[model samples]
Target: MPNHDQLPTDEERDMLRGSVRGFLGQHIAGARTVDAGRQTERQLWKQLANLGLTALGTDPGQGGLREVVIVQEELGRAGCGSPLLSAALLNLSGVVEQANDERVAAVLAGMHTGDHCIPLAFGEFDGDRSAGRPALRSDRLTGDIAFVEGAEGATHFAVFTAGPVLTIVDADAPGVMIEAATAMHLGGQSRVRFADAPTVRVPLNKDGVDNLVAIARLGYAARAYGAARRAFELAVAYAKERKQFGQAIGRFQAIQHKLANCHIDLQGVELTIGSAAKQYDAGARDWHWFAAAACVLAGDALRQVSLETHHTFGAIGYSEEHEAPRHFKRIHLDVLRHGGARPARDELADRFLGGTPDRLPEYDLGPAANEFRGEVRAWLLEHWSGERRAAHQQPPFAEREYDRAFALDLGRTGWIGLAWRKHFGGQERSAFEQLALMEEMERAEAPRAGAPVQAAMLQVYGTPEQRRKYLPEILNGKAIYGMGYSEPDSGSDLASLRTRAVRDGDHYVINGQKIWTTTYWGEYMLLAARTNPDSKPAHAGISMFIVPMDTPGITIQTSTTMYGGTFANVFYDNVKVPAANMVGDEGNGWKVLTGALATERGFIGGGIVLKVAHAFELLCTYLRGVETDGKPMRLDPIVRQKIGDLAARIESGRQMMLYCAKQVDSGETPPHDAAASKVYSGELMERFGEVALDILGLEATLTEGSPGAILRGRIEQNLRHSLMWVISIGTNEIQRSIIAQRGLGLPR
Candidate 1:
């Protein structure tokens, strides 16, 4: 009985974020300036209670899990320890909603008035917290529970016992001993010993135990995310100000790449947390899967960002005076606090592997979008068979007629320009629909709809005349475009090209040699050349035009690529193009080119994510069926760990792509985010291919047509094609610079 529509509006979330940020700044500024060991002041906790944050999520209008998370993140960023998460979110959240126990109800009611603080101690050394363990108990409980958060501040302890019961015990009750333990983070913990302590067992079931643990795990994840975010910001600031050889370290490729990775990790944590919160708000029973996923991924991210940020700061970060160690310590504690990575991975794998194959986490595009995905999937399953995939899968960087033919077939259905306006021969679909199309096409390994993509770009920056001349043919699947931006000298730096186009009455004569052009099969070349050679900045005076592929003086020499694909070294010797073919007014090509570049980066990135997902699935499926030494390879401990890690990373990239698409749909131009997606996914492709090959061993090296070639040698083929992902669409290195400068607000 999940309410799929229960998500908060963007405006409402923004307002909540602003108010929480403002509150933390006003009350916690002086506190953060001090060391991490000091506890959150009682006055500040009272102020939080006064604002009703402790009680905000109990009612629909007051907010829900998402609102609580929003407040938690800001509090964590401030390094403040008010026990809001441990006392309110973890201990009292579901209890207030589900139970009628008088003591529980009284504790919950008093929590909002800052008169009570109850800490959860469900974890024991021997048993799963959700499934209670054996303890010294006849009528009272006796055992030691480890890592009980907020233990030092608790007035009472909510302990889970062998009865799978939630027992409420006074902190100072007979036989109770609380040994204080030092934490690396802001909060305090204790080893709570119950030597036959008097206890009140509340009515609770197995489901209730699991729900409590899930709440605790998720709330801890929010705090970890905030700490990691702060760490990344600190790193970026240090990189910009800390001088290395001569310039700021942020200008160096090494630092930029690492910081960029930090950003990617933080993004994954944010998205996963948001998804889990929404699931909880909607009353989804499957919310536990998301909670587990978030904890595992967020833990790794927090650990990674903390380490990298510390590295970026050098020795100063290791000092007690710096804030980096505090965040670092907190990340270590949180990562291991709630069952750690191993157990979480096992939980996720059980859902995906032990049950139905359909348990694999696919993007839930809502009911309408799911219907659209089904329609598209059905069409693809019918049309794109094994044979079609083989025929169109002509490695990376190749342009095949078979691919174009398939695209033309899709274009006929009005699916090619789904994101374009309806009047422009498009369906005017939602971004989610477009994303669904991209993901399905990638999963099927179908022919890329590249030609129609250029047509869609034309809809954005093309002149009306240009659209009228070329769009119809493209819409009807007639014309395809080859890019003409990169020259022999320019790669990612597209503005420094030496190609020149001079006006000659009604035509412009073009002379340039373009390298790495993959659109040789297209009907037209979307060319970029300089019209004013003397313009102050090299980027200015650039012009874009549509040149006929069959124009007299044009020559295309094909070069074989490393990945078994082909690139066209297109040369133009005094080629003439009509003035009407120019995309925009003279000197406006830079704007047009950069705009198109952003779109291309965004969409190209979408495919890479799905490709990684497909590769991971293929690896899992192969290992599941095949055996070594009469045992399934999937059963090997090392193999399981490797695949589990890969699965998490792949899903992370998938979430990143979806978020970028959402930004585009909202009419925000996020070039940096688009670049981040490309950067993370491109490198991820390389890593996945490497790890998969390693796992599959020597037989995986055989090429297609070999007797025992695995997946028809697609694994080896992917190893070579992975380079194209990192190098093409803008090199991963270039994308890192974009992320550092634009996304992190660092200098170029």
Candidate 2:
């Protein structure tokens, strides 16, 4: 297994996730079906937002989009109100030229200035065949828009029209009517009508006809990410609380398998959305087709997740008071609001020459992929050592000495750079072999925290001198690196970083800040800084640097998160470095950063997450040992059901991890593998935490070390940590955006 000094590929993130188990056990409320409008319980949202989510779409000059995305999923898990996500997406829209009118710009800008309500009005799918035009009209918008979610509190609506006539209308416009609609979702909706509301006019094909639709599709996908995340939590929570035939239902095979299916669907949809978001953010032309497909996939995904979630709860899920009904209501209402399922799909087919018949070539995942898997597994077994096994027993966020030693062991065996080029201390193994190794590691529940992804990326794109300096450190384990791409205001937008590095003769003076630097204590950090402040086209003037953690004037201030890890605010106040320290050429930072995640953004715990999965499995074994009234907890169907579901999710998460491995083994980057893996794995971790807490009942609130606590408080820990999984990395919303843009090729 890989060690903590390594970072897992996006596909392998779930491995080290056990850190959250303790939190979930302690903080996540016990699982008795959550009440409707429990939305108020989302104290987690306020806690995280202050952690600085509003700045995600802004630049280093403002904040970051990555953390915003990460925070987005946590909000989803909590099922809270949000204007941050929409603002981030809308900001991206403006950047890519998708926002056509003045109204759109104001709407987006308003979000950053304390505006908490921004709703979008794309026509909802009624699951109908009526050819009738939308009864809603713009004299000005004289009739009701059939279905809209979150509209009850909207200040403005970004309305999508058929022709070149999009607009933003005030919710309280003159002659406007807002009737609370009978939506099936747990979140409510409304039918908005205008007798003669004044609407701000915008272009339909301002950029391209397909562009607006793609943008609209992307928005839905984002919302779906929010919805699906909640639904998964709902089902998982229910599985643990409801018992049947003398055991927890969660332990039952039938319920577990059903949740597994939902897990898979959730992963797929999340992947679709992530692909789309990436395409839009990167300004990939000809991405409309991809965006449409992603929308369809995302749309369908929420529906299935919502439906399965309800099914898992049976009759209890049906009660209006149950959270399951709320999730279903959101799914059904949102499903139709944008384009139903087919508009996005049909739009996708129209873009493809053969109507999406030959859309994406099938990734070879059969014999060869499996064979590659076997080879890696065999190799890992052969290389298994005494210290490595011992290291596995330590928690993922354990003391650094243990992680560093374990990482050293992996480096010694040459597994750390098994796929690296020999010239630079790597084996220069084939891409397939690299992927094969990852597959084996993930399935084996191997540690992956400290892999040299940051270093290797620098090597691949850095100047020769830069490579000479850091490549050895990466290989020898003297300096494991962490990514500094994210900052308070600069998440997904690579070009907007404001960390500035200036030249002063022989040295480059770095002055600025980088936040969300994951391994705040790692030996070295790969920081992106602005070398050319006025470089045209936004992304053209950046440069990469290998900055030491203890560099003078460079302060790494740590911020604690509810998830238990401390991300740092790395401040550089004229920190001086030799000009030679710059990675690649000065002003070539964009090129270097572009492929930083070409392999993957990384597993949630990077190298250490899989350990959590193993720990969760251990928790499950212990859960089976629990009992309340003179009977083993395993005897209760619902308890069994919840545990069974967790087991299955672990399996599915592993499979998704493998699918990414297969893609890598096939010699190409798995486009949506990370998104697919991250969403499911994150949800899986969350569900496990929630279920464990629920099965514990009132006793669940007791802390792990508290007197008479059940499962040693493992349930509460998992419950709290699950929320972290939702927000970390690219956050599920950002992942969905990537899917919609990259996989589906939708508009901005």
Best by lDDT: 1
Evaluate residue 605 in candidate 1 and report its C-alpha lDDT on the 0 to 100 scale: 74
Worst 10 residues of 1 by lDDT: 30-39
Number of the top TM-score candidate? 1
Residue 156 lDDT, candidate 1, scale 0-100: 74
Question: Model 1 Cα displacement at 687 (Å)?
Answer: 1.6
lDDT of 1 by residue, 160-253 (tens): 6655766777877898887766666444556778888887666567766666667667777787788778878888988989997799989887
Count residue pairs with overlapping backbones in model 1. 0
Query: What tens-digit string does per-residue lDDT give for candidate 2 at 152-261?
Result: 65667655555645556776677766666454433334566766677776654445434544555565455556657777766676677677897767666566556655
What would the TM-scores of all predictions be?
0.92, 0.49
Model 2 residue 744 lDDT? Answer: 32
For candidate 2, give the lDDT of residue 497.
81
Listing every candidate in turn, what is its Cα RMSD in Å to the true structure after a full C-alpha superposition? 3.1, 23.0
